[model samples]
Target: MCKALSLLANSQNLFVNLARVAIFIVMIWIGGLKAFQYEADGIVPFVANSPFFSYFYKYEAPEYKNYKNPEGKVVAKNIEWNKLNHTYIFSYALGVVICLIGILTLLGIWFPKIGLVGGLLTAGMAIVTLSFLITTPEVYVPNLGGDGPTPNFGFPYLSGAGRLVIKDVIMFSAGLICASNCASRILSCCACKAK
Candidate 1:
């Protein structure tokens, strides 16, 4: 068993292949959950209510907030979901994009290029989410002195947004692996080289 483990660890191809497989499985799992709304033990709600996901659930539109424009007048208002009609659509679209990126990453069809693009997009989303958090701190705090603190108490430290950031970082690392050593790696793991 130790010999086998050593052999696997020493094989770069095996490591990359395993990374690809693991990434694929994760994509499928997350995509499946989003596509089917699969709820296990009410975990979905808990995740949705998590503080890390607070940005996704509640957005404070610039228009709603009392912010002065260049002319010193309030140009943007504080926009809330109740007043918006397309929030759900936007949310679903973002979800779909994330799932699509995951699927493409799993397939490894474009080697490093596709994975790189996905990673960049994921990073962008994470940045946007972080910006939102910085811009709107109230959404994360408890309202009306509610029961306990929000679900995801340690949001910025380990929220859904943080998870995505980490995932994208891994994806980007994989992309680098593909970009730097794609030719040899593909020759060993994929059938592209045979043709």
Candidate 2:
């Protein structure tokens, strides 16, 4: 039993490290996408629907709607217009912020202090993303109970938005674990120095 427990405990660090690396990779990849034009366009729905983020799109809201056709084809001119708007500016800024978080988290590989801070920052971001499950309707699978495509309403029935945000829960836990581990190591190092 002791050997079994010991083996289980030893794998904890490996799993935690995997989670941390996963978050960093996701942040960098998603942020890099948001920095571009098409992705900037795609994120409009999410940003527009977000109460916390909607203010950024207030002035350009009409142009945003204008970009869409009945068939859902986005016209070129309005895409250009959106690219020039404050909404796009905010998105690009957000992208830069996400990329910075990933880079900082990566720095944790070399410095425990950096890791702790990065872990906390990533955890904060994960909390905010998870909030979307409540704030954004996109998270809920639409058309259920009334004989539509999606037969269920919540939880496992999540839409694309929900799937995206729900995955952040793991990141949140991972970040907390990373920070805790880093904190313990740092404190132990200090204790040794004092001794």
Query: On residues 1-195, what C-alpha lDDT tens digit does candidate 1 reach at each position?
Result: 999988877897666656656656665565455432122111222223335543553333342233212222222331222224233343455557667766555455446556545444544544544444343433343334445656444345544434443455555566455434444444565576566
Error of 1 at 147 (Å): 16
lDDT of 2: 0.76
Number of colliding residue pairs in each model: 8, 0
Instruction: Give the lowest summed-lDDT range of ten residues in model 2.
Output: 62-71
Flag regions of model 1 displaced more than 4 Å: 1-6, 31-85, 109-195
Record all residue pairs in model 1 with backbone atoms less than 3 Å apart, i.e. clashing.
63-76, 63-77, 63-78, 64-77, 64-78, 64-79, 65-77, 65-78
Report the C-alpha lDDT of model 2 over 1-195, residue by residue, as the tens digit: 999999989898777677668778988999998876667776665677666787877543434665642234667786666755565788789999998888777666667788899899999988878877777665788764677664687655788768877998888888888888778879989999999
lDDT of 1 at 81: 27
lDDT of 2 at 131: 77
Residue 31's lDDT within candidate 2 is 93
lDDT scores for all predictions?
0.46, 0.76
